[model samples]
Target: MHESLPISVFIIARDEADRIARAIDSVSDFADEVIVVDSGSRDDTIAVAESRGATVFRNDWAGYGPQKRFAEDACRNDWLFNLDADEAATPELVAEIRKLFAAGPPGTASFWQVRIKDVFAHESGPAPWAYGYNQIRLYDRRVGRFSESPVHDTVRPPAGARLGQLSAPMAHRSIRSIAFHVEKMNRYSTMQADDMASRGRRLARHRLLTEFPLAFLKAYLVRRYALYGWWGLVISTNFAYTRFLRLAKTYERELAARARSDSGAA
Candidate 1:
């Protein structure tokens, strides 16, 4: 018989004192265990988590995946729910999770896809709330760990692990300001460049013209970012530009290094 699981809610944060409280409040009702792993935050983030009765642990700054993986591993429960400090669990979702646990532990359900209510800076149309943007938030800790991608870290559920969906929606309130976007791009782009370099990919120049434009069109126009009007357009454009900048900057650095090597060899 599968043993009943103790559901632990974990969040990895850095300099998120302003938003961490909201995230914690959202899940406070349903979560049996709330764990917050902070990565060298310069703000009162640690204090906020501690105030909420959450188990707070402070560590040096690491990449997203590694930080989350560390937090997950620190959890003392069998079942884990990974939440960002900017994301909140809706009351409806909380109730659903409670019911799920009440019916004994989830044995076959190793992973679950929960809907994400992606709130934008300006609510233009319907707020993009629907049956899409699902993420594997709740999962069995034993299934698989989070990928150590410095940029976009993700949990890789184990093979043959049953995946389910929850009716409740997880509200994402992080991607609001332009400042956040810029800083995130700077950090993630650098990480991505390092990732590509590790793979030994050759430098390519044409990527500048090709990748940037396409990224802008795909994210802004094709993805209906126009629906949100100017702000959305700006956000989408920046999103695309960030990706381009990552590749372009990395390629340029590699090329310069190669030329220096060639000159030295001659």
Candidate 2:
């Protein structure tokens, strides 16, 4: 009925007790192996994952890319499916993956996952894709690896690697609550700003002024978040705010560096 590929489903998490079970269960029906790598989660995250038939391991936090790479190395299969703690594959997606493996993974190198459908509890269910498309996550470990950035980590696929798109989309349950959204916004913006700092990037005043409004417009109009009504408005505002915050944090860091230099001269 389904195809199996000795595929290993690897998830790197920390304190994800509330949703890790669902993420793991989504793949249990099809994955050959499932592993969860924890990074000092104080909660019962470890216990929950273990109960869900996932082989659990504790590893120190080493940034997103490195931690994911660590899990990638631990996988026994050459094919790896990296899923976020909050992301789950729909049944149709599972069927697609089965079909892909049965037909053989894209000879081009690895598979790029479909832009996950963002789901919210308030709406009927998962919202339709209107606003943005996401990058790839699933790939063959042999030809691709995630970048080792301390903050901005993206998977690097080999040259000429055919990146095929999956027809089935992963469900992205991102907005847990307003409080959680704000916290996540702060954390991710800081991480992004830090990555920019590492690359010696500075914020331009023009960019600082334009980024938020442009981001809001793109999220609301280009991405078509407007179709969702109130939910769309919230997401657009959140996107715009996130853009502003990342630029603001980067600007703050730049100002701090300038102050330090001026003080040294004085």
Q: What is the TM-score of each candidate against the true structure?
A: 0.89, 0.93
- The numbered model that scores best in lDDT is 2
lDDT of 2: 0.83
Worst 10 residues of 1 by lDDT: 123-132
Stretches of candidate 2 above 4 Å error?
Answer: 1-4, 103-109, 130-132
TM-score winner: 2
lDDT of each residue in 92-130, candidate 2, tens digit only: 888877777776655654757566777765643465553
lDDT of 1 at 67: 85
- Cα lDDT tens digits, model 1, 1-266, are 23334788999998999989988888877777789998889999999998987899887767788888888888998788889997888878888887888777776588888887666645421365222377889988777778887656677887777789997788887575888878888877887888788777775678877987888887777667766677667867897889897898798779888899999999
- Against the true structure, candidate 1 reaches a TM-score of 0.89
- Clash pairs for candidate 2: 108-162, 130-223, 131-223
